[model samples]
Target: MDHRPPTIKEIARQLNVSVSTVSRALSDHPRIGLQTRLRVQQLARELNYEPNTQAIFFKQKKTYVIGVVLPFIREEFFSQAISGMETAAMAHEYTILFGQSYDDTERERKVVAAMKKQRVDGLIISLAKETRRFDHLQALESTGTPVVYFDRVPPFAEAHKVYCNMYQGTAELVGWLYGRGYKRVALINGPEKMPASRERLNGYIEGVSRKKHKVDMQLVETTDFSRDSTYRAMEKLLSLKHPPVAIISFNDYVHMDAVQYAHRQGVAVNKDIVFVSYANLPITSYTAFPPIASIEQYPYGQGEKAMDLLIQVLNEKGLPDAGTRYYCEELAPTLVMH
Candidate 1:
């Protein structure tokens, strides 16, 4: 009446052989004779016997499972990135343990702790928006569990990371806008504490300088990425004596919010005020006012590369220089015109 799956011990008992003989025969060991191997295999198939992968993994000290933590799963960018991670993991006979931080540092810490408790082979993470301290991630590396970060990575240089180089793309966007005779440009950036915000600001400055335009702080605004905050930023820009003809947003989400606010004020999107942003997401196409152009950050490539890097780290764990090794990749963002 027992419903449990047949085990090696049961197989051995049925064949009147030792457990080692059954195990060796199932593995096609050379020491086991042909007849015994065939008999054990036939019985295994008939009884629906399956190898206990958990026991094998325990003996090997490897789970063949990786943890992936991102800020938000609903965001198309993160979803595409995870898809790339999944594809790469499958090619290596591994699988992902997925978690979402919802942009909260506390939630990210809890998810990471849970993954560690599960003893994942390694971890790939895109940091939460509010994560400033990396002690939690550092603890994992100290325990010999490799961690690779992608997209929203930490500011440190010692960590393994893969990310998009947005500076060049943002600069290119400025030059592109200038070419179209939109000399007065502005930017709607994210929280000042974020590294991404700094990258976009630097690029905006460089772009303006390249066109012989003086950097104007009055034209720039920072938003918390909330709808009300985006509306306030839009209002500030519109109140300028000479408003910018083109505005570069932090990302597609911010662009959507800013565009909606602009519409309420009768500002013609892509005409009276042209808008451009990053993360060339497909969802933007359906928005009432999509950006005239966007920077392709290649989230999928970032995710794949991050996973591949983590796998490499896991492979080289015991090597002499593995402890000192670090991998950092910065993919150049491309500006895509809509």
Candidate 2:
């Protein structure tokens, strides 16, 4: 068995038809008779004929592969997201090439450049915290590849965005804390540039607005969204002029770190101070004293929706000239109490 890629010429020779007829029939051109199309398609499949991608791309002006960009694959959130994307891609008969930027702009630029040369059909991205310049993204889109921004999307990109209801989740957590009779509230947030920080903060502000509970801006500590930074920031916040009666962390990682900080200071959460964290990941539940409350975001569902919408665009051969917007799917987060 010759394992080399089969060509249209071989199929045409075996079927006793001109190469032009074979090509048109194999592509299922409507003008070609159904019987002719079926015969050519059957032979093409039997020969496992995969047209030369470069030439076929020149003809169809599209590639079937998609590029996926994520901030950190090590995080369970992206792990679940990527898994959903892979499942959807398989159903659509499309391939996904992924890159992890580790939250570095320069590293992300390199990956984008390489994928550009690969001629990926489109892009699906969950932005990194350090991604500030939209120029690279614009350049890739200018090449006529559609882009779908998923969780942690660009702050200002008017593109198809699939994201969680962070605000509602945050508000829910904050309301739960107040109901628990925690007067003072503190925040250990992510890097100020990321969009999640703003939304989560907004929810906190809105939730605590009616109550006389004054928001101690001094108690709001920001870190690089890393475990060490979150822990250090929590330590500083706890050593404040007036420690919070209740503290809310950015997500599970922040919750875990803040809990560790409290442990070091001989404080027991839900006893001395109630704690609520967003993104109730599995690891958070396993901790000695998990977050008093958490936001159970749908990472898997988000990934699936992003890829499904992208498939609709891909199967259309190409998206419209003007960029499209797939509105954010509103998913109410689950409130998990530890």
Clashing pairs in 2: none
lDDT to native, each model:
0.92, 0.81
Best by lDDT: 1
RMSD of 2: 2.9
User: Model 2, residue 215: what's the lDDT?
Assistant: 63
Q: What TM-score number comes out for model 2?
A: 0.87
User: Per-residue CA lDDT of candidate 1, range 21-97, in tens?
Assistant: 99999999999999999999999999999999999999989999999999889999999999999998998999999
| Candidate 1 collision pairs | none
Which residue runs does candidate 2 get wrong by more than 4 Å? 1-5, 24-55, 313-321, 324-326
